[model samples]
Each structure stands twice: as structure tokens, then as C-alpha cells.
Target: MSRLLLVVLLLANVGTAIGVVYARHLHRQSFIELARLEKTRDELNIEFGRLQLEQATVAESNRIDAIARTRLGMKFPEASDVVVIQP
Candidate 1:
């Protein structure tokens, strides 16, 4: 009976050690994945900032006016061309 109890205890200890090893492996894998995701998030944030800057540049009033004049042949009205009416 004593030998049987010892065998059972040894088996339980081995099983617990295997569980610990698996848990450690999972933790390491999770840490690596977290690092990868954080790197991707940082890269995307940089790209988003660049895109926001480009959008701001494109949306500036002077840039719009230049494009209108150069590409669309638009022009501001001269004083003689102005017509005012009471609304």
C-alpha cells in the first residue's frame, strides 16, 4: 500500500510539472504576439500621422486656390465685374 501511494504521488508531481511547462510556453508565446501587435500598432500610427499631414496640406485654402486657378482656370472677380443687390 505504501509503494502504491508513492507511485501515485510521483505521477501527480510529473503531471504538475508538465502543466507548469506548458503554461510557461503559452506565456512566452503570448508575450511574443503582444510585441508583434504593438509594433504593428506603432507603424500604423505613424502612417496615420503622415496621412493626416497630407490631408491637411491638401485641404489648405491657399493650396485649393492655387489648384483652382491653375487647373480650373478660376479667378476672383474684378471690381467692375461685381454686382451687388439687396437681399
Candidate 2:
């Protein structure tokens, strides 16, 4: 009876150790995943900042006018080219 009790206690200790190892492994995996997610979030934040800057640049009316006049060679129509059509 004493030998059986000793064997059971040893088995329980071994089981508890295995559980601890498995728990540590899961904790490590979760930490690695959290790190990867944080990296991805940082990349997205950088891209969002870049896109916001691009939107601001594109939304500038003066910039559009400059591009239209200087690069596209657009000009205002002459008075004779304008027809006064009112509803």
C-alpha cells in the first residue's frame, strides 16, 4: 500500500510538470503572435500616415490649378468663347 501511494504521487508530480511545460509553450506562442501583430499594426500606421499626406497634397486646389496650368497647359477661355446661357 505504501509503494502504491508513492507511485501515485510521483505520477501526479510528473503530470503537473508536463502541464507547466505545455502552459509555458502556449504563453510563448501567444507572446510571439502579439509581437507579430504589433509589427503589422505599426506598418499599417505608417501607411495610414503616408496616405493622409497624399490626400492632403491631392486635395489642395492651388496645387491642382498649378498642375493644370503649368503641366497641362490649360488656360481660361476668352470672353468671346463664353456664351451666357442662363436657365
Candidate 3:
């Protein structure tokens, strides 16, 4: 009976040790995944910032006017072509 009790205690200790190792492994994996996700998030943020800057640049009035004049062949009306209406 005493030997049996010793065997049981030894088995329980080994089980506990295995549980600890498994938990540590899971923790390390989770930490690595967290780091990877954070890196991806940072890269996306940088891209978002660049896109915002590009959008601002594209939306500028001077750039729009330049594109319209160059690409669309648009021009302002001559003064002689103006017809002013008194309201």
C-alpha cells in the first residue's frame, strides 16, 4: 500500500510538471503572435498616413486647376465674352 501511494504521488508530480511546460509553450506562442500583429498594425498605420497625404495633395485646388487646364484643355472666358446681368 505504501509503494502504491508513492507511485501515485510521483505520477501527480510529473503531471503537474507537464502542465507547467505546456502552459509556458502556449504563453511563448501567444507572445510571438502578439509581436507579429503589432508589427502589421504599425505597417498599416504608416501606409494609411501616406495615403492621407496623397489624398490631401490630390485635393488641393492648385493641383486640380493644373490638371484641368493641362488634361481637359479648359480655359477661363475672355473679358469680351462676359455678359454681366444686373440683379
Worst 10 residues of 2 by lDDT: 59-68
Question: In candidate 1, which residue ranges exceed 4 Å CA deviation?
Answer: 79-87
Candidate 2 residue 42 Cα shift, in angstroms, is: 1.0
Q: In terms of TM-score, which candidate is strongest?
A: 1
lDDT of 3: 0.99
Error of model 2, residue 29, in angstroms:
1.3
The local distance difference test score of each candidate is: 0.99, 0.98, 0.99
| Candidate 2 local lDDT, 1-87, one digit each (tens) | 999999999999999999999999999999999999999999999999999999999989999999999999998899999999899
**CA deviation > 4 Å runs, candidate 3:** 77-87
Q: What is the Cα-based TM-score of model 1?
A: 0.87
Q: Cα deviation in Å at residue 16, candidate 1? A: 0.4
Question: What is the per-residue lDDT of model 1 for residues 2-80, given as tens digits with 9 covering 90 to 100?
Answer: 9999999999999999999999999999999999999999999999999999999999999999999999999999999
Report the Cα lDDT for candidate 1.
Answer: 0.99
Per-model TM-score versus the true fold:
0.87, 0.83, 0.83
* Cα lDDT tens digits for candidate 3, 4-87: 999999999999999999999999999999999999999999999999999999999999999999999998999999999999
Candidate 2: which stretches are off by over 4 Å?
84-87
